[model samples]
Target: MAAFEGAANPSEAIESGYYVHAPGKLLVDNISNRIALRPSSSHLLLGGIGSGKTTQLLVACQQINEIEDIHAIYVDVSRYTDISKITTGVLTAITGLELAKLIKDSQDKNVIESIKLIRNLAHGYTTEYDPYDDFYDDGGQYIAVKGIIPKKTEGYGISLQLVETVSKLAKATFENYGNLVLLFDGLDRLDDAKAFMQVVYSDAKSISSSGIGVVLIGSLTAIYGDYHDTVDKSLDYLCYQPFFDVENDPEAYNFFEEIIQTRSSEDFIEEAAIKALIRFSGGVLRDFITLTQASIEETYLSGEDKVQEQQVLKAVDSIGRNQLLGISDNELKIIKQILKTRIFIPRTDEDLRLLVRRVILEYRYPKLRYAVHPAIKPLIQQILD
Candidate 1:
């Protein structure tokens, strides 16, 4: 993990969603097309980790802020896995510039009182706040408060906190700025993708009617394949994966180049090596970077200072054994389910999709298929026994 400190190339920062370069243009294009007429559409930007989801989202936030007089918040699902953390993060993001900008002279008692009242609507506030009580349900639909969320010991109140914050920011921003947009990210990295989607689906109607625009980003595999598979469900019914029909729906090669192009060593990463890396990584951006990083370090340790195609292949092999491929008992079940469909043959790309779907469902399980996952051939046969 530490081997690729400088990251062997320039594009690593791009992979981590910092200094967004490649995907920023594409994402901004999508937003432009959306904002032309609708201005905002609740989109579930799906991609594997390091697939530029969060980077694209942050790009969206920064870009959208420039377009409309808006109130926006971003919910990071990693920490906000439970209800409490969710509420807190949502509320915190939603408060937006409202605290320091609007309400006027916040140092003054009246402004502080106003902020306190607003804060009460959020989870942690001890003061009394019930939307049904003093607030009128006149012009727009009266937003009902979800009730007070207790402070969490670990990850409990996060979700609640996030929603509360987003709601307040949306309402307040609309009152002052005339438009609001809230983005929820990191739903893919949660403990249960299905549960996260459940929260989203349950809230979708309300989110649509709330007079606030929202853009959600997560992995389609997590939302549709992984958690849903455990319950015996199909992906078609959930939030439509926008680019499902595109031939390279996963866009692995493009995504690899997308991240790689942004890094400092554009000239150093040879085209052949990039192709090999993409093919080896099965097109996931995260895998590409990890593999690249691994390969670069391997070359360095082997006395070569540059990235070579052969070095990339060795790196890919090492990455597979060291990281990309691992299978747990639960994941073995998923792999077995996929194997049931694939007939245990590495004949076609469709088979690869099934395998990838299962792999995506659970990284814990040994993901290396008999043909794809490098090495451990003797190891898996030994374990399966």
Candidate 2:
């Protein structure tokens, strides 16, 4: 079935009519319940690439808003600033600006003035409300505010000013909305592990101390291995979004089958064809949809009404070749070891990078397991041989 298209965020996924309420929904609800019970609780939600962290965050935001007296402010850090070099100042400013945009339509004059003050301080310009272009989902809710490098007369002192401005704005927001929840997504796009950690521990702590509930999206490396111990001490909750078990779980297989069925009729994909593609997908939702999309294109080119065994193989070959393009000799060595012994080296940057690239897939079943992506495994085996 051809209905599924990979979405970058949950809003788009829901709008696409392909969004499924998997266990991820329960995860969102649990986080919301925690925040509702303890208004000051903060959490870190972790998932690998293609694991749907952004979509989950959007769902969590919507769920949190449904709780009375709680206002949810979502700030996509990648949109407003360079996530790599994100400091306390940029993070706080971007957040304040989003809060301002959320309440700008209020009747309270003090709230409106405070929002204006936040916009001016953060953007060096006030956001002019235009009903035509500015209102009603012009791509994003907040105005795109670029990252500012404090030129001369800026540094720690400038950072202090940002913190103060954010504090003032937070006070106004709390006064207006009753309670505030910060949903920080897209932190996984940041390149530096150390920079991300610094923000999580130091900057995030300072902000949460002001009674604002926070839920941060983080990379797998930051949630597992050596960073795990460090993150454990810093967060109120560490929630892991795990991959599906395609090999043993019937429902997991059916979940993906339904995705295709939603897009096209059952007869459009043969039983063997869909199973083969899912085997190669390694249970990652994005990878599953992408491979299926390519297969559909190949079937169309071949003048076939339904995808069969041959189309799936060809699609895997194309995907495998693309994955093999830039893999290093050392990475090849690691892949070979995993293939031979079925043992994964402890978490390291190089290994984590492979997982990020989707060259490797990690699963949690009877126990933790790692495997080369099924699409690339045969290719890798042929190369190693």
30 Cα displacement, candidate 2 (Å): 2.6
- lDDT of each residue in 162-184, candidate 1, tens digit only: 45444554554466666656666
In candidate 2, position 10 carries an lDDT of 54
Mark the regions of model 1 whose C-alpha exceeds 4 Å error after superposition.
1-28, 39-41, 75-114, 120-172, 202-209, 219-261, 323-385
On TM-score, the leading prediction is: 2
For each candidate, what is the lDDT?
A: 0.48, 0.75
lDDT for residue 128 in candidate 2, whole number 0-100: 42
Which parts of model 2 have CA positions greater than 4 angstroms off? 7-9, 23-26, 105-113, 125-158, 224-226
